[model samples]
Target chain A: MRIIAFASGKGGVGKTTIVANLGIALARQGKKVLMVDTDLAMANLSLILGMETSPITLNDVLKGDAGVWDVVYDGPEKVSIMPASLGLQDTQRLDLTKLPGIIKQVAPKYDFVLLDCPAGIGEDTLAAMASSTEVFLVVNPHSLSIADALKTKIAAQRINAKPVGLIINMYAGLKGEIPERDIISMLELPLYGVVPYDEEVRKTFYYKKIQPVILRNPDAEASKAVYVVAGKILGIEIDIKKQGGGFFAWLKRLFSR
Target chain B: MGLFSKLAFKLLGIDDTELPAEQIGYIKDISKEYSVPEILKNTFGEFVDSLLHKHLIEGVVVFKENSLIYSSSPDILELANKLYEMFSSFKRENKVLYFNVGSWVSMFEKDEFVYMIKSDTRLCEFELNAVAKDIAVHGKNIFLEEYRKIMSFVKV
Candidate 1:
């Protein structure tokens, strides 16, 4: 029962994207995975997994209105998702301290439990971090992002939830971008993976279905990098599952930037 | 601080690792019916609904000993955590606690609990005293109603 939180000190570093793709990749490797949208306030893991209106969400379980198992929804391959509620009213009267116990109830059944944490270190964010066994900080290649990730790392340590590693997202390899080695040194954590900035990753959200990049176009740079992260976690090599659309697939990725 | 930790902090122009927004944002536990803030809020809300209906008061938050029982806004919830230290002073002489921090605030106690009322305008100290008396008795009814709901609905 390895419960891990994918957190970003600042917003928009592809935290949700990495969690969704990694969950799918792990599931493909014959590992039981459960991805939870712990962000209660602004949830998107459900959207990427193609579950827009999840009738039962983590909100219900926190409020003690529903059982933890009752809210678990099946995702791509063998992955199970406990998505956060989309409704505005779902965030009300939530007792987040009960989260650890709720995760504990269902954690034994799965090999991996991935928490999609909310941005900013508010009460909601703290609750998610406290509920997980370890935290993985996500940052972009820049000074401010690294600075924020450092604060997130310290916060995780104070609560006794060790921040195990770092994942650099949207690496464009442009000038003025902090080198990956510098990011690792400043954050003082091992680098798990680096996801290259890819347009195909954006198409998953822009297109009709709102699927994960790993499923929509496995050959995409962002998808391959995410699989590598998943493979490292699962201790196995992953061969991208290719669904042949060939030239038309290239056309789809090109236009959906 | 390590070599890189100090470098990142210096480069970003921030010295403190603790961000103001990163405080522990919840009551330590919820299964203890006496400690749940929502139940206290709902119970006190019912008692103050008439004043709220008349627009005489903006809102009311209830706190029992240390735990904040209820607050209308999430922003105000953090304020409750800062208030426990001040509550001890109210036990001896300060029958009615008043402060003006943007919103007019008043706190009066009844037994082990304290009720905080927020108003747009400054309220007369004597007048607040009388209202506090009425609430002390009325707070009992609201407690019964909330407790019944919690007993039936909540497991934790």
Candidate 2:
């Protein structure tokens, strides 16, 4: 299983939105994706997916009341989430020595496990990096955002976490010509994907947008971009507008039939 | 004196910028070296004479196991002398000096304080937290590569 972690240097930079979208995108491609809400204190991924109260959460699993099968819930777009409770301090104080065993128990069941990590270089982030194989350093195009990201990269290096690439979320339009080149050069990390700051993404949950754009509006420019990224992750070329011919085509037709 | 100075300078690489003109000439004359700069010779001669009679810094013998433990600070000299007396009374082998580096220097032997010197910035690590505390306490060595140059002036 490919364990990819989504992390940001500072909070409120759409880390959850990226995880949610990536989970759906992967699932649409017939990949069994598991989205983990590891933000223990202020868990918000459930709210984003419009799930008021999951029958089981990460707290229950950590407390051993429920297994991974019991806690995983279907999200908006067929993606599954191992939910977490808000204001969970006891679980947050869990002994770090036992985290790897817990991950190993639940990791092998899915094709992709994406962890939504907390902000800052605290123990929680360190634990997440320890459990993850590849780290996605999420950032916006602002100057201070890039500066904070550099500090985050140093912290990641301290634990020897392999950085797969940088995800430039919230791509605001060309106003004064963004300094994208300078940031890429100074950071020395590859640009994985540039998710445009669109209203569809912000309104995805509220408006009941469950299907991946790669499945719905395959001809749209943003959908095409996301499909290309999804294809790269799956090690195959996918034409977003091809309608129904790819690795997941048989499953798509199985559902459509 | 001149031969000793050359040997010391050669071994330590003490540059001309760290020495006065008069001391340079005196050192040159004692070693039968005619290359003494005139001004440096005058300064060295005057400094030595003051050391002999003025009791300015005379009693300070900065040794490892001597009854007399001396320091060069004018402000904290009284407290230092009291501590020295306390140590000397017990026959303890120790002395201490306060440096501009804003740190306390304690020595069991004279050699410890004899080598205390400042560092330059260009040679040391760029990050402030990575720098050695005593070397960076003065805040001048932030420039880099200068700590190595100042090492030559230390009386090893």
Candidate 3:
């Protein structure tokens, strides 16, 4: 089982959303995937996975209030999410150091265990890193994001946690944006995949919308990019929904399925 | 210092930007090879590398019966003495003290020894309920490496 922490230095970079979608995508590939919301304070993974009402969350587990199995809820696309409590009070007084031991207890049951680390290098972020075997830095195409990501990568290294690669998410292909190669050179990690900006990512989970963009719109550019990254992780080339323009792309997407 | 040098110190895991320059050098003197006292080496022995590598703990000051025991720097010795003089009335075993502005030094007392551990962040909700008696069990190092860089400037 592979326990990977998805961390980024900055917030509002869609770390939680990508982790949720990736968990679903991996689960669709017949791999038992568990997505743990280690953000603790500002948690939205449970809501994204449509399992926000899970009474026993990772907060309970970390606080010794509940067992690990008790908090594991079945998510959409057969993904198992150890969500964090939405309650503001639940974030307080948690024995976060136990996260490593807790992850060890549940790791044997899943092929991919993705942890959504809280933004910035907080104590909670360190706990999440300590729990995971490796870290995947999620960066956007920009200097600010890359700079923050470098610090996050260094933070991961301090704890002896291996930061595996970079998944450049939310790439808009803007003219002045930092290119993928430069990002790779700066962060010093191999490219996992680049998820282009897709409106479907926001439209699906804006407020009450719970379906992840990957499953809701597999034909979406972002979804297809996620599949390619997932395929790389699985060590196999996946059949992505073909991209083109208008009618031809529609036909390719339909026939490719 | 410039951004590049700051980044370099941060990359070295000895950058504590939280603390000001005078009390502790912004760029901690991690390069200076200081000898570990024979008594401290006997108490902590070979554990320095593990702490330095695995954690970012600034420095571990073990004060025995209000007497300086482990801290190498005389300045920290003065601060530790002031800490005891200032907060002696408080009977709490685990207390977070303001040894320096922007830096939180947590004191864990057991028997007669005071284990003052400097950790980055968590000044408000800072308390290690565990590791009160035994300092070795502190699992949360939190940016103490940067703390140590600032601490290394504490001259004996």
List fnat per candidate, in order: 0.00, 0.00, 0.04
Segments of candidate 1 deviating more than 4 angstroms: A239-257, B1-156
Docking quality (DockQ) of candidate 3: 0.06
DockQ of each: 0.02, 0.01, 0.06
lDDT by residue for model 3 (A1-257), tens: 89999999999888988898888778877899999999888889988777658777889988888988998888887888898888989977798768888999999999999999999987788788877888999988766676677777766665556789899999876565667766776677899999999897887876455777776667788888888888888998877643223576567645643
User: lDDT by residue for model 1 over B13-121, one digit each (tens)?
Assistant: 7646332221111111111211111112344545456435332567666676455665645666655555545755555554666777798877777666676777887
**For this target, which candidate reaches the highest TM-score against the unseen true structure?**
3
Q: What TM-score goes with each of the models?
A: 0.61, 0.55, 0.67
> Which scores better on DockQ, 1 or 2?
1
Q: Of the candidates shown, which would achieve the greatest lDDT relative to the real structure?
A: 1
Clashes of each: 1, 20, 5
Tens digit of lDDT per residue, candidate 2, span A126-178?
66666788888888766546656666665555344656778777775544323
Residue clash pairs of candidate 1: B37-B69
The superposed Cα distance between candidate 2 and the true structure at residue A138, in angstroms, equals 1.3
DockQ for model 2?
0.01
